[model samples]
Structures are given as structure tokens and as C-alpha cells.
Target: MLTVYNLKMPHAVYGGENAMDNITAILKNHQAKRVALFTDGGILASGLFTLPEAAVKAAEAEYYVLSDIPPEPSYTAVQQIVDQFKENGADMIIAVGGGSVLDAAKLASVLVTDEYGVKELLDTPGRAKKCVPTILIPTTAGTGAEVTPNAIVAVPEKELKIGIVNENMIADYVILDARMVKNLPRPIAAATGVDALAHAIECYTSKKANPFSDTFALEALDLILNHILPACDDPEAMEAKNRMQIAAFYAGIAITASGTTAVHALSYPLGGKYHIAHGVSNAILLAPVMRFNAPVCEDRLAKAYDRCCHEAENRCQSDSEKAEWVIGKIEEIVRHLNIPTSLKEFGVPKEDLDGLVEAGMLVQRLLVNNMREVTPEDARNLYLEIL
Candidate 1:
């Protein structure tokens, strides 16, 4: 029997052009002072810093930016900021970049009152009661870090991706100013948009799917289906990027409630082992995972598959026909976006498949959420099939 579940997001999420202008009001409502701004260097140099920098001044607080974030940030990197925030005495944090930067800030807050090292969040595999308030400002359309309760962090010694990095790491606020995404590379735009699409699809089809989350997921899917290509085609079009960015955030909220299933569970190993980047990993694994789950979800996915496919491909009227059409559409998008199609492309040997399988099995949080019960053997077969 299906059940009803409540869905929630950050306090407020603002989208569209000049959206950052509302930051002062958001901070005023929260009475944020002594802020520590967290972001990557690229965004630090991207002129976006100006808005937040000015907002901190207008709000009359001592906000300093820590911009040394990497493409794949580790817990050790986040500790550096935590120590600084401790000494600097920040009451609130302003996270202003892609998912990585926002995640770093979220994790840093967890370490604020930690008796042990910052690594506890990654190593413990559970929830934390102590964390500081962070206002998340997403500069990209993918990752949806702002609304997501979980943060994906890589741990070097463990050689694994931490999906259950911290359950309570959810942000206090999320500002989705589309202006920040205007400068993203077209390829980055396409890849992240696909990540958002995967988030919606997998959550909607998962074992934990519920009525409320399904509403957000399906609506998010519809927006991405129509607007992602436009955002990629013309990055400066704030309208298109705005819709996709909003869709990504809503998808994040949707998945937080229902959880992402097979596609996400399978995508993790690729990113953890190969360092393929999360979105690219999802793009590589989505088609194969969808095909694998087709037997269970075909009845539900048929309509989505049709909508995702273009007119040229959807002429075939049957559901199975539409499934094939959907695969073709995805391949076209991946090909145009210039992401590799297989693990071999990332130099994962036939030998490395098992290692990837073992790593994935360790992420029980996401693996258990699969629409069907999955064993290590099942995961191995899926990796081998893709390999």
C-alpha cells in the first residue's frame, strides 16, 4: 500500500536574475552576523563574490570568504575552514558556489562542536545533532546541494565516496540566483542538469516513493525535460537556467524525502573509484541502470520516457518503443555533452569492476534505497554489465 509523506526544503529559495539582491533581506530575517563565506576560487574570481561581499557589508557583518575548495573536496579540506571559523567566531555561514562548496560548509558546521576530528561525520555513518546554520547560494544548476539533506564527500584514506556523509547536514537557507549559473561551461551545464534529472527519476521510482515527493519529483522532471537543453544552448538566458536551477533544487528536496534508487546507487562506485565527477558518473550509468530496472518500473516510466524523448524519436507509440526512444535521447545528450559512455573510457579495467562493486556495497544508505532488494552480487552484475 502506498503511503503519504511530508516533503520540506530550506527556509527559502530565491531564483531568477538579480536574485542575490534579496540576500540582505534573507540574512536580516535570520539576523545573520559574523558570517564566514565559503566558496571555490573559480567563483571567487567569477564576480559573484561581489554580490555576497556587498551583502555582508550591507548587513554590517564581518564575513570573510574561504575559497580553497577543490573539484572533489575531502573532509580534511573542510577542517581547515572549520578551524578558521572557530577562531573567527562566525555565527552564520554563507556558502556561495557549486555543490562542492556548499557541502564543505555544511560539513564544517558539523565539526564546529565535534570532540573528535571533522572526519567523524564521514566515518561514523549516522546523524548529528550539532551543526551551525548555513545559507546556501548555488552557482550551478546541478548537485542541488542547497536543498539536499545529504552531502557527497570523498575521503582519501578510505578511498570511498561518503553518501551518508551526514544526514543532519541540511542547510538553513538556499538562494537559487540563476545569475550565478550564467558563466558555467556548456558541458558542465548539461552534465549537472542530467544529474538533476536522474535525481527526480530515481526517487520517483524508488521503494520509498511517496505521494508528496512524487509530486515534486514529477514536476521537477517535467521542467528539466523542457528547459535543460535551452539552458545549455544559451547560458545567458536566465529564464531557462532559472527553471532548470529551480528544478534541480526541487529535485533535491524530492529525493531527500523518497531517496534515489538504482541509478544513484550504481553511480556512486564510478565516482568514488574513478573520480569521474558525480554528474558524469550518473550520465554514464543512467541508461544501463534504467534498462536494468525496466522490468520493475516500465509501466510507470513509459510516460516519462516519451516526454523525455523528442518528436523525432517518440513516433513509436508503445511503452517499450518509448523506452528505446528514451535511451536514444539520453545517448544523444551524453554524446553531445562529451562525457564518456563506459567505465573503460575512465580506465577502469575488467579487474577494477569488483573493487568498484565492493566500494558500492559499503554505501548501504543509498544501496538499501534501491527499488528492489540488491545484493553485492547484484551490484557486481550491474557494474560488469556496464563494464
Candidate 2:
């Protein structure tokens, strides 16, 4: 019984070394005279923007950098960019940060033409649509916002991390520059690497996954399993960091097709309500959610186990043997990355558990993608177990 699904993505993408080198040519082809570059402070400090700067200047275009986007971006922040984009008449947006920055830029592009602001986009009946062309450049190997058709935004008024999911949210161009990520801090690397791992695992076991997505998901999972730890220990290893970047891209492509599951669905509340980083919030919940969903996806988890622990599998004869092997490998990866194992370690109070579950339930957009239906009880239990 195959189910119906839909997938969308970036129109053109440039990856590998000097990929940022192609930005000028992309601008020329698009005839963009003004471009808005969106990034966060971390990326601005890293100075990877120099490559894009030269390209924008070479194109003789008016460029402005908005580096105010935070890890958990709010609609207030998003609309400010939208207002600037419309008032300044900048039609081409080049997002140059991590997932939140790219998502903020994507929303700003969509809302600039409308009479409304951020609140209306979320509350209004119809607002998010393909309006302007955007080019995404990711500095983190975590959220694959570069290629996906959905943007995760914070709605502070509602105290929720809402998603603007639409085909129009896809970037017109995606530029992957490995040099940009070489300076990422160790903690950032581990958190984002876990994020990419979560993305691949969630999408592979998602209810929406199809054959096309399976290809990307398995490859991404394999790469993260093989490379993330090394990338953390040796950021100098161009080979390992490059693989992690590609893994993030592949994971992004996988989610674009198959969608993210309960881990992502449950993570939004922490980001929106508590200002937790998206990757870290997702990271803490990923293992627990997987442990919960494993039964529903035992065969899928077994296959993922096959990817990482082939030698161990030869001695296993039961599903329990394979499940333990799979869980152990995932745990080892988390240990390698040094991501916090518990939500409470990050200041999440036990009292907020109910609200988090409520928020998760309202996040119907992502919950729909879960392989198992996520009830309020299920969401609560997942959080409590992690606690």
C-alpha cells in the first residue's frame, strides 16, 4: 500500500570547493541588481562572507547584510527583513547563515509583497507563496535549509516554532562552500552533525519516505555515521568536513522529499518558547524519539543498523539483537559528538512538559510526517522519558 507524496527543492545548486565562486554568474543570469544577504553574527565573525562579498561587488550590485537573525528566529525578526526587502526593492536574497537565517530569509522574501507582516503570514489564510528568488549558503552542516521547501520560523506571540511549508520556500540557488564551515566551533559541529543525523534517520523512517528519498537518506546516514565524529575531532580534515557538508545536503534533500519526523515535530516548542537552538533541541530529543518510534520502525532501524554494524549483525539472530546494536551505534555517535543526553541539562523545566506536548500537537505540519501517529500522550511520554 504505497502512499502519495510530494517533493520540491532548489532550482540550481553549486557544491564543493569554490562553489561560492559561482554567485556572480548566478546573479548575472538572474539580472539581480540588488541582493540582500542574510546571516547571523557567528557567520559574520567567521568572515566566510568575503567570498560572496567579492562576487556581489563584482556584479556591481547593491548589497546589504542583515546579521541579526538568531538561532531561534522570531517573526518579529523575519518581518523586519521583509520590510527592508520590499522598501529597498531587493528582489534577490542570498541567505548566508545556518538554518534559521536561511528560513528567515525565505519568509522575508515571501512576505515583502503582501500588505501584512509576520503575524498575518502565520494567522492569515493565505500568504506564503513564491515571490522572489533566493540563494542559500549554509555555514553549518546541520539543518539542510539550503535545499528544502520549508522554513522554520518562531512565532513569539503564540510561543511556537512554526513552519512555513510551501514549494515557494525552496531556494532558487544553493551554494555549498566547505571552506565556510571549517571554522565552526566544536560544539556547533557536534550539535549540527547530530541534527543532520536526526534529519537522515527521521526522514528515512518517516511515513512519507519514498524510493527517491530512501536513496538520499541511506547515503546521508552512512556519511554521518562514517564522518561526523572525525569531523569533530579533526576539523582540519578537509575530507571529513567535506563529507559532513555533503551529508547535511543529502539529508536536506531527503527531508525535502520524505519530510522530518517526530523529533523535529517535538523540537519546535523548545526553540520558540525557550530560545533554545534548533539543532540542540532536536539533538536532545532525537535519541528518545527514536527509542519510542523504533518499534513502529523496527525493520527500518535494522537496515540503518546494517549500514553501521554489519559485523555485529552476523552474530544476531533476533530483532532484539539488531535493535540493541542499532541503538548502541547511535549512542556512540552522540557520545562522539558530545551532545547533551538529556533535555533537563539544557534548562527545560519539568513543569513545561504539558505545554511542550500541547505545542507539539499544534505542530500538525511536521507531525503529519511521522511514521507513527503522534498523540498528545505520545508526545508527553517522549518528553518525560527524555527528562
Candidate 3:
């Protein structure tokens, strides 16, 4: 842990029954006449935008929809959306979708300047400042993009996804209505739920783990490990889904203080080059990376096992046993969720090992946070295992 640590959070967060109604109140408080609603076609098609739309109308605020954002979007793609948002003459932004939509909205909030765009931020993330206040409503029980000061976008030329971190990008308001994710598709729920799981475990074992992060990480682990399956497998499991939404938010808060480790570091290349979904990529790499770090993080893992498996903690005799059980439980959860555990299904070629190693090693921001050091050789072996 660092000698000094800090925590940052949104100005306000609203959740539980009728959380979307807060949107109208927020709009009235901001005294906004025009609002830009950000989302994707899938959301619009599924009518998931209804509640937010109703809230926006209730505020009597005229709004325009920007729904061109795509999954695993490139920096250029984000730039395009930001440009469009600027032309809309909107005073506030309400983003309602998955990670991609939220990230694009966050970038838009900061990139309102003509002096710099998303591409420029890749080089100097601190150059831009937030000009428009944003209300982020997550449509998935994962990603936590709503609360983070980070925005991830694919860098096409580099064939790697990069995160643009700036305190200015954090949401001014976050709405965590479980109704938004209540009917999420099984595949999406599974992938994103595991992604939250990765965030919780990774932050707990991070080299930067501190009291602020541990408080949220452990609670998030308990909530997610216990509720994720029921949340994803049962369409009517609103209670479980609500717990997952909160767990993802807590895990995301943990990330702000402690950051993620090798699993996220290595998953970027897969999303950047192979166009794999970010959550799915993390799901694929989670277990293998944790198993690699087991020796160095066994104590942390044992603690996590104790917290997450309270009912079964007596089954393990030693710290090593507890640690192994935690890892095994992760594997079991992934298997039960039906998320693919290998790159083979994605058509990732074994011959691309050298390229994958090169790209993954470049994510030093996260690699340095791993409790156990990850060398290029280790990255290659890990990728090879998945392939």
C-alpha cells in the first residue's frame, strides 16, 4: 500500500426503485434546455431507452439521440461521436447503454474542445477538461464505466485498446437502476458479470491494494460470487440482478483506487486486434492470469475465499487450499456462465504469439500493478495456453 491513498467518486448516485426518475430532477437542477441522449441501436430497438426517454420528457427538456456508438469502438469512432455531440448544442448528456456507450459519452463530456480530440487525448490525457456534465446509466451489470475516470477505445493502427484516464471524465451523476439490466441477454450477462468478478479479484490482489480499495473489493467479491449465476441464469431474478449492478459499481470504485492487473493488461490486445468484446476477453484471461499470480497472492486469495465463500470456508485446511479453492471457484463460475475460456473459439491463430506478446507487454500501466511481475516470456506462455 502507498503511504498515502485517496478515493474519488461521482458527485451523486441514485439506485433502487424508480431510479430513473432522478434524471428529471437532475435535468431541472442543471437548468438544461437541451439534452443529448447517448446509446446504441440495440438499446433503442429493445425499448430499453423508454424509461430514460420518459424521464427526459418529464423534465420537459428537448433531447436528441446519438446512437452510432459501436461495441469495441476505435478512437476515431469516439471522435466522430464527440463531434456530433458538439454540433447538437446540448448542455447535458444522458448516456444509457453498455460500456461502449458510456465510455463514448464520458469521452464526449471531456472532448468538447476543438483544440484536442480523442486521438490527442491518447498522447496527453490531461489536456482535456470536462465541459458538459454527464448522467451515466449502465444497461449492463458490469463495466462500471459510469463511475470511472477512464475511457477505453481501440487504437486501430497499434492493434491495441488503450485507456484514456483523466479525473475530468468521471460522471457527474450515476443511476444504477436494476431495471436497465433486468432483461439482458444471457451471453451478455455472463460475459459482463465475469468482467466485474475480474475487477473485484484483481483490485484485491493488486500491488496498489489499500484500505479504501479493499473495503469495496471484498464486498463486491461477496456480492458477485454469490449472486452472479442467479442474476444471469434466471431472467426474473431481479434481486440478484440488483446486487450485481451494485457489485459492479463497487468493483469499479475499487479500480479507481487500486487498478486492475495482468488480466486486463493482456485482454486489451484481444479486443483491439481480434475485435473481441472487452468483457469476453477479460473472462477468457481471468483464470489463467490468476493461476499465474497464485504463488505471490495466495494470502490475498485466501482472504477473498473466506469473504466470498463464507458458508464453505471450513472446507479448506490451509491458506494454499483456500487460495486454490478461490481459483477453482472462479473457473467453476466461468464454466457455469458458459463464457469461453480460450482464444481458439475466436479464431486467434497460434502463430500470432509474438505479436500478441508485444502488444500485451505495452500495457505497462496495468502490468506494473500485478502483484507478481509479468515478463514478455510469461505473457507469451499465458497466451499460448489460451490458444
| Number of the candidate with higher TM-score, 1 or 3 | 3
lDDT of 3 by residue, 1-387 (tens): 655788889999999998999999999999999999999998999899999999999999999999999887999999999999998768999999999999999999987778999999999999979899999999998998888899999998999999999989999999999889999999999999999999999999999999999999999999999999999999999999999999999999999988999999999999999999988899889999999999999989998987888674368878899999888988999999888999888898888999999999999999999989999999999999999
Shift in Å, residue 16, candidate 3: 0.8
Q: Whole-model lDDT, candidate 3?
A: 0.93
Model 3 bad stretches (over 4 Å): 312-314
In candidate 1, stretches whose alpha carbon ends up further than 4 angstroms from where it belongs are 1-4, 123-127, 165-167, 306-316
Alpha-carbon TM-score of each model against the true structure: 0.92, 0.94, 0.99
Clashes of 3: 0
Candidate 2 structure, TM-score to reference: 0.94
Each model's lDDT: 0.76, 0.82, 0.93
Candidate 3, residue 17: how far the Cα is off, in Å:
0.5
lDDT of 2: 0.82
Q: Which order, best to worst by lDDT? A: 3, 2, 1
Q: Write candidate 2's Cα lDDT for 1-387 as tens digits.
A: 126766676788898779998999988888888888888888778878888888888887888988877776777877776776777768689888888888888887777666766677676525677677898988899799888877777888777888777677888899889887887899988888889998999999988888878889999998988888889888578899999999999999998888888898888887888877777788878878888888888888877767765464356656666766767777787876777777766677899888888888988877887878888989888888877
- Give candidate 2 regions above 4 Å deviation: 124-126, 310-317
